[model samples]
Target: MEVSRSMKDIQWLRHRVGQFLCVGFDGLTVPSHVNDLLTTHHVGNIILFSRNVSTTEQLIQLNQELQTIAKQGGQELPLTISADQENGVVRRLPADIPGLPGNMALGATGNAQWALKSGQLTAQLLRHVGINFNLAPVLDVNNNAKNPVIGVRSFADTPDMVADFGEKFIQGLQSQGVIACGKHFPGHGDTTVDSHLQLPTINHGRPRLERVELVPFRRAIEAGVDALMTAHVVFPAIEPKPIAATLSRRVLTDLLRQELGFNGLIITDCLEMNAVANTVGVGRGAVMALQAGADMVLVSHRLDRQLDALASIVQAVETGELSQDRIDDAYQRVANLKKARLTSNRRVRPWAQLIEETRTLQHDLAEHAVTKLRWESPLPPSVRRVAVLVDERVPVMVAAGDNHSPVLLADALQAVRPDLHSTVFRFPETLQQVRTDDLLAQLRQYDFVLIGINGGENKDYLEFVHQVHAQSILNVTLLLRSPYDAHLVPQSTNLLALYENTPWMAEAAVAAMFGGTADGALPVRIP
Candidate 1:
């Protein structure tokens, strides 16, 4: 029987190469190209995105299939299935899933315990869905007001605030046996450009970076975070070159490894992003990233790009351009992480009840984070004839597959004040289509005007807000994404930054408007 079992063992899988390539599957069903990568190369880790998800059942089946395929191919250790479940904007989980308020909401609550609960709850949900790794707890200190990407996704503006929440989040996730990866290492927080679109350069010197950007990363490391994801931004202060952090050995090996002393696996942000790919293509970028000490290269989105990246890395190894020792070291590090973090047997819970419990926690965070920015005169107006105008740019998440939740301020306010008479105005479908004269006339009908701006970076939204401000209408601005938008609004505007337009958060913010309890500290300073 022993001889027969030995004979039945798979052969091709045992010789699996390119352990550094941590690629993502294509879509809802695993494509042939993806399977070929997993089977031929024995790629151990697979990241999931929203496009790949439809329902929980499908996701669970996909995860099982991927793992079974790995096992069948003779790749021993369990394949690490990871997802971006950092609720609020980065959530890949289905809309029905218990999406927690984002990091900024957690930060605004000013409670470490809540953040810990968020992490633990998020881990439990992902584990149930057969996911072992969660790329979450965005540890970047969002100090820049003009930052396009790391808005409400970040916890706070200050290093200490982000550190406290991030550490607790790591502790909570790891305690439940889910690997927590602190993301966008060396900080992508202060960039005006989105890394997905292009390479953002951070001009902060060592002292400035140490004071803000590196603070949360260091804290996350000290708290024993299992993984650190690299940012694609160029740190001129550290590297003095145009090379992204993903490709800079000086940034990754010297700064992060030597100075910060991070021993955990260092994963690169998606190589498919324009920042890296545009400069050197995803294939070359992957090799460069691995050479720069990245243990895993995430080539997400395009399967062709992913395969090309894997082939490039393999070639680099074969040519001695990337030493075998480096490959082995990365493999060992990733293997150790998988062995420690992957749950041999996950504890099953009543799915319905678990979601319910998580939803309760979400409510707690939203209520506590609903802060009162200005409390001068009569708040929660005695006469509630409210008018809400939402920016046309505020995306409906269900349709866009984006993390941003739609602005439901009108509904939330109506929920809080049952007798309140309110109407919501929307911008036209096309850009610059909303009739300014008609909008102003409609606003003039209401006692108090409420303008909703979604990400706050759109010039049209800002233009509208300025136009409204010019009218001398008693309108208060509600920033639905980041509080930093308050900087762009008129100084006289009574802005209420909800951080996220999540349902519970919208309700909580509206409650404050109607005198419920506008009760959170400003996480980021607004000019």
Candidate 2:
């Protein structure tokens, strides 16, 4: 029943408990605190974000130094370096990294082959940078149009299509030796709230859950997925009382482990998230997650919180509050996963070659994902002047954990029309009354106007679009973020849905607007 050797052989089980804690720090290199966590606290895993990465060479060095620190700390196994490189809108890598058309775009293509290629390319890029695990291929079926977090992250609205793409993606990841994890298990797609801000609850009964939420997870497991990350949203249908799935025994152990038959590692979402932190404190929540059946507890963000969570778990085991058998089970799974996936032979491919390959794949996928909602007519041949307008504030959701970057919409359009005039309106404050009038007056002189819409909430921007249409100018509205906004806008002619605001998506959309082909269909419903 015991995994490896008995407790008598090891000097201290406290170090073994540290393996369960995966922490994040804020820098391009390992800070003093993170180094202590690895050397003294014996933490064995790390999660990287945009703040921790700059260039490919720098990131590779950081990861290598991380492994060296773990080994010097007397740890026996190679550290598991993980990231949220989901490639679409949630990408954590630098701008130069391939920002593939994400999930919904791939779903729009309706070709599983693209999903397979996406997974392979993503794995190649991650492994090249020393990342051994990818928190990607979002299996959540985005059926809710108002879902703030998972709109373009999910593959499709239906379970079968999600499963088909998810399975292919898993195969692609595992083929390249990087572990793929299907995330926000039991579905975070049906809710309107972002779990990073507060917890949301799903009321769907068991049958509906089995049909929709659990389908992709089941398929991922069958495809030999190495891990699954838990969602913090409450599912009252499964658990008697209100509890987030991350800390619910019925959800993590009874349902995910027993009923679903998933033997892979079960990892919790960040304990620092408000969904867990606001309810049951981070340290206490970490203890509860392990006891409830999670193989690894993520306390991504604060060093103090990570140490506290690790200390809490050790105390729970020592005080008999958490059984040693549970600790052993979780540790064994983590160790087995490392042994199977982590290798010393991981070679970093040439940065330029990897970038070229990934961009090539992204360009092809973007062409297939750009959907032309409506295209009435092309611009008149005699047009001498054109105006391009885009929002200055791109909506970077809290859930996105985005390090702000420039949107290339105007740049992409300017490449085609060298004489095009571009405007970037500021958000919240709205364009000043004088500035708005000046912009509209300028729009009247241009032969064509191009407007960018981000989720369609800006009333002032919408009003400006209407004024331009009223002037009878040839204009095209670009749906930059949400696909549902295609119906919400008053003027619906020549609307292009790009779903995401990434640079690659922007270029593909601009190409489609000017005589280029965009054959993608809508994967989700507007109504």
Candidate 3:
């Protein structure tokens, strides 16, 4: 294929030397605009999010169409298709698909083998759906429990634990020819707010960062991570610019590229995140990110901004504000990543086989992580009746119309112990309306009381657990959502951190209640 250099080709030549192209598809369908963009711009890659995905079949069709579009555009290169499949809340594919357990659950197992299996299984599923890159196995050591965005998304609170898991995860993914990206570089685990809504600042000194925040990232880089996704947070102590890492050359270039010796692709977190969009126009953010050493700018949410950004970058090269060498460096990195994908031998494992393997691992890990936090008396081998309490504070379900209670937990418990009678009580309504005498009367009838805190800050669930504990009922609290609620059951003996209310976790919890395995230690310290 002879590559021509017309005005459009010349623009491509200028941008292609060091720039990456971002193309957006409309759901699972490849729109004309995307086709035109790929043909005209020779865009380097595509990123898929939940909005772009509906089913595995649709995703595979979309990717095949994208490749056909690129080939017709006179670009003979294989495009890198990436997705954020961090399991749990960040899963791009449907839940019914062979999704691995969330990072926190994997971390709780305290076994690198499980982490490796998770990465391999995730890669297998992604590869079958035509995704070459997984922006996953989040390397962030979420030390801060209050961190709104990266709580259960992170593997653990300690850097050593996260690093160990992340290293094995990278190995497993790469072994399967799936490029694993260690994300939110420099760290997003310590922030108290979501960067998608606002720019967060981390005030830790450089030494502190090297010790705690940067440990997992450094380990991941050492393990040969294919890419590092920059965070949107600012570290005021390290850089005086007060800009997010995505736009700060001091952070991306000086710290990540130079200091860390990371020769792999430096990708940015979503440009549509509030940290970038609120500070600078999306187009400008793209340009600045490239200038800051980001090899691939992820403008996943804003196409117009991406187009403008590409234009600005091309102009900058022409005007000599950005050097051709820097452009070439970035372009080479992206091209190399694509080349690596081409050389990789990715084969689709049977979905049934993958699911069975993943399910067994998830069950084993969950069994190990179920901590017996509080138990006043010996757990009765047989319970005639059970009263279930579900927390109403947090949004348990993802979509708008879904109910936010732990009804599944009640069902699973009943399935396991058929003889035990189960009654569910929603909060406020049960607290304000249901008489204490009646509740006590009901509690007296049941041999055990199992409290499932839906989701919330530690104190709210803690107070609820404490009240249940005070009643001298056979108290067993199951945290169906966040481990943050584990702090409240300090004195209770039967506490289990099921991480999330997924069916796998719930099923595992039921088995653990029947004495499956010894409860594991809490990976994160309950504060």
Candidate 4:
């Protein structure tokens, strides 16, 4: 007996339900268990991270294998391979791969074209590696200086600047066939708590949100971004306590869908994060997110949680808790995205030379973006012995295993000043680990001191930097992660906000230090 057309339609949708999920797997290579999601479940998207990337060659081979597995599954849409290629600290790509100068660095340049070029270059590289989705150009306005998570990831402090640069970046990426995801919608810029730790509450009323956070998102939507990721933070103005934009009808459906008119794929930030799991647990949160308005639920980092979450969504739909129409709508939006970008007929480029060529582009962006907030004239000569002090808070590169961009800074400085004697000290994050007396002694010995503030979100490091600067540390140049760090180091000294500790920015900083012209202007205000 032949199956009825309605029955076939339902079967298509059952496969599509799996497409609604964008899940991650366990290792740097294809794990045997991933076949469970691939063949049996018909999952249509896969997220990659440091645990799943060791080298560019590995990544390329991994993507090829993933595509083969996905193709063999016989799904209508190809698996949307994606990664958080935001560069700087959040970059998931291998360390050697050329990365953009991150958002804040681009913002400091105050040139939308630089951001566009950055996005385009980034897309070119990610595409070469077989990844088509880039969760990037984070449009969050970094209005809150002490915001634990967003800091340098945000483009600017003002909505207008964020909007202008964000749209341009989106244009650059999608133009290159890589999907640009404008993230943490309704904005994750103001929160103090990290979603990886707990749910953050953003009490900004609709008016405040409209003036600040919502502006960039509206601009992104107008600019035609392919995807928008929801924030896990609760907004009292839109929804009650505990119901974040990730799982709120008011925020997601009523506000983003109806008011803002964003028809693109709406993805949830990783459900396995403490923000969602602590509140609703991953499985229940996934169901609620689908019910709320999310098109794709991202269950990254935990395989058990991913399977459980997918199972929950399917069960919820079967039980009528989540409307089948919602699933169909979401699945269709994802399908449309795959149809548009993940084309089978596109010519893939040979990337052996791509990295070298793009490294030039990445360096240009960093050079154009290094801000000279206050440059002391006749900045210390290359012959002078230099001491570089890195903040204890800098995070190690996840995939490169132990890639510290500051080492690149030291190497660059040494190359430019062959006679330069350099002493670089890594400050520990804890007060117990800080050897202030020992550090001060080295500062006194060197002809000049250069402090590298990597991830300067901690107030403790600010105070530490202030103490060193107060001792009349002569000819010091502060290479900052956030200009907000200016609060600690006064403008009386040579201050430069590279915006992030990218190697390209580090090379740019070295150039500016040795009397090279720095044309970068401040992109954010600091008091």
Candidate 5:
């Protein structure tokens, strides 16, 4: 069938409708080609990745340029700029912004007020850099200790615990008018694989899912989250098809929309992820995602691919394969989101007040989260010597491949106790190499032995803990990266799970170790 003149009028309709499609750009500045693309295709939103960001001033300039491009293209609409500012390791503005602890750290304190403070600090930092949206407050319940990616990112292992912390975080962000997105819906916290590399499958049926994974999301929705991002994992038992949640209507439309009644915007994780890109072409993935009920398709990279996908979507609508009503619905949702953002008074409050509030809450929460796993003897009146065994796999922001050896811990200990003598032992490989003679010698010398498990791989850490059966020694294990390693230490040991391995956590650990304050228990259980 020959297309009608009205249908062929792509340029006229592009201004009003097609601009809802968001795409990324190549350079730091919005190039002329990007302006042309926006003018010609009406692309609406832009997502900033690590490549697009360098400093706070640069990010603000880039966002200004993008808005200018939108205006020059004859579109008066405000461009939505988003970034992954989850704090800790996922921070984009590391230099200017203060590195705060992750969600699990707040949850560990079992305090809702700290979660609210984290949100406020995060939102203030984001607004300073002109970012309007934060894809954060990962609502997944980290029930599985073997979960590779979502361990420390999640607030806690229990749904109620996660919900308690996440609800406050969402409210804190939204209270400042920054769009808070609760993500990886239905959930990604229980999977053993990372979605960036491949698709993960969750075996829990609907009932178990409602009780565990779905609880936090449900509470977040009820608490009024501004947006929701779908996961790239598949629940084979629930959806049967091998498609990720981003492309599955059973997960997105039927479950999240109809069942849970979430009326806010729905966004895909990222089209560039292997879970979507490897299975289907970006063009088809875009079409399916819209058909599956996504308000925004986040293309982290590959601008040309996103343009092609947009063109394909336009063609589908013209050919009668896709309904114009569906297109209109998504366009309206996007426009509404932009309109809401424009009207929002997201102004910065006093910086000193914000910082003071953040510090006060952080100190309080850290004090509550420092758990005493095992204390063999009563508190000694005088300290003698201490030895700290540090794991080498934890990720440092400045250093790429390094370990959290005993040196860092000993320094922290010394900072708390000036008179205490400290010794450091760096474990190059497995703990098996640390001979029993060496272990016994160290055990005999030190009044207390504090072991720090830096990251996820804890086979050696656990074995080393079991071998050192010293009753006089207080085994204080600090979990830096993933809290899953907390289970490796015996229940009798003095264990403290800090969730994140950031510099701030190191400082918090120092304060909590010397009885300066009482840190709370583990927010999540270790089974």
Candidate 6:
């Protein structure tokens, strides 16, 4: 079929190609560069990070401004605004927003309904803020205990458990009008490396990949998931080369689209990650991602990189490096999704009512997720001198999305013990520092001690726990992050796993510490 090459047709094709690019920018409001991307460059979608979010009103206003800009830019469809509101620590919302304890927390409860409810509540929260697309419900089966990034973000270690929770979560989001995307297909749960820092390889054979890693993603597709995000890691079983899955035709197109039968929007992970950028470059990575069958190529930060991606896509089509049919197919998918979800009349719920409802849900979920592993030691009585130590390291995994100081556990402990002395120390891996003798010497004066561990993989953190046990003082340890740390702690220690460091999880841990109820179980086995 011969296509027209007139100026009007070329402009239309440019607009269509731009729709395949989901870009991000700094700040809460629409910046001048981003405005140029939408108005002049015809970029049609955006992804919001913590930097672009603040209060509820501010977020709504900002989204409204983005839509206004898109409309004024001569685009016919409403822009699909997205955020990583994954309901746990990975969420992009502010601290005040009511949140769940995250996927592993929900998995601890062993009730798939909570996953569904969390998804529904998350959808309500996003829809109320004028955000329609939610990049969430991580379906990765976290089988590897040493996984550096996916730890508590995943639902469970087993494929069936992850699939059960993931299917319901997807149902929750799509039913409530927000698009839920199952991420990092075929899976990122077994990796020891962070894709943001470097590209990792999954060397599993085809049978192993189908049996373990591909289970949740297969279920997600069967459950009618709205979209699937490609991983940046290399899968040699699916794609022979060392190329990441995001730029692999066999992985993204043959396996995910053909074999798995997923026909929804296929979005690439941020092309700016070292996995893609350091290797093929973001511009070329974007072109390769599209050619590999990704419906949308995301360049999440840096306007220059985004522009580079846009130009690369245009040039690929102009030079016949990319087929016109392929570009049109991707555009049609994006347009179809926009018409179905974005064109609807979306009315934000009443603010007071929404807040109260979400808070109630959050509290219930936290209570259900706080697991009491074992309490060999007696609970602390009314002791005057008490020392509280917490891992003050920012999350080593960038996907954890925690950039601020962690004070939730400290604040919660302080509320209970008015005279409690708290100490915050950096992780050994974070600053190449360890727990000091001076800190332990100060703890010797206290009759009882409470320790919070977030960096369980760090040798220094585990060593500190061993040291605290040597003191023979009564103590309790809370695994504030991944519960896998429970194995690293002393066997005789009283331990609790909260799976996340949110305020709700902190309060639940404190309640359990003070002889309150924490009946949750471990979602993953400690090996």
TM-score, each model?
A: 0.89, 0.94, 0.90, 0.91, 0.85, 0.93
Q: Can you tell me which runs of candidate 6 are displaced by over 4 Å?
A: 1-5, 393-395, 403-406, 416-444, 456-462
**Candidate 1's error at 384, in angstroms?**
5.6
TM-score of 5: 0.85
Residue ranges of candidate 1 with Cα displaced over 4 Å: 1-18, 377-385, 394-407, 414-421, 428-441, 455-476, 491-494
What lDDT tens digits, residue by residue, belong to model 6 across residues 44-127?
889998898888889989999999998999989989999888877788876667777789999999999998988888898888
lDDT of 4 by residue, 339-378 (tens): 9998756565567667776777777777788887887655
**Candidate 5 local lDDT, residue 417:** 66
lDDT of 5 at 122: 83
Lowest summed lDDT over 10 consecutive residues: which window, candidate 2?
2-11
Give the residue spans of candidate 4 off by over 4 A. 1-14, 348-353, 380-382, 393-408, 426-445, 455-473
1-527 per-residue lDDT for model 2 (tens digits): 35446553342677888888888999999899988889877788899988898987899899999999999989999999999977777787766566777888889888999989888878888888889899887999999998888888888899999999989998888788898899989899899989998999999999999999999999998888999999999998998777799999998999989988889999999999999999998999999899789999998898788878988888888889899899899999999999999964666678788789887987888888899888886766566565666665555677565533333666776765555556544443446645766776767777777777776556666777777667666788888777887765667578888878777778888778767768789989888
lDDT of each: 0.80, 0.83, 0.77, 0.80, 0.73, 0.85
Q: Is candidate 4 or candidate 5 better by lDDT?
A: 4
Q: In every candidate, how many clashes are there?
A: 4, 0, 10, 1, 14, 0
Worst 10 residues of 5 by lDDT: 395-404
Q: List pairs with backbone clashes in candidate 1.
A: 371-520, 372-518, 380-514, 380-515
Q: lDDT value for candidate 1?
A: 0.80
| Model 3 root mean square deviation, Cα atoms | 3.4
Q: How do the residues 1-527 of candidate 5 rate in per-residue lDDT, one tens digit apiece?
A: 34677655776665644555666666677777677767777777777766677766787898888777777877767777787777655666535545676777777777788888788778887776778888888898988877766776787888998998889999888877788999889999888887877889998888899899999999999998989999989998668988888888888889989999998889888887778888886778888888888878877667677777777777777787667887788888778877876556655777677667666655666666665555444446465777767666554432111324446677666656678787776564534566756776667677777777765455555556666644455556676666666555555356666666555566567666665565666766777
Candidate 4 is scored at a TM of 0.91
Model 1, range 1-527, lDDT digits (tens) per residue?
A: 98777544422312334466777765798888767767777877888988788988998998999998888876788888888887876787776786788888888888889989998889888988888889987888888877778878888889999999999999989988999999888998898888888889998789999899999999988888999999999998889779999999998999999999999999999888889889999989988998899999898777778778877876787678988788788888988998887746767779999899998987778878876665443443456687777775653332125544334777777677778788866654422565777877777877888777775546775676687788867877777777765666755347677887777788877777666666678787876
TM-score of 1: 0.89
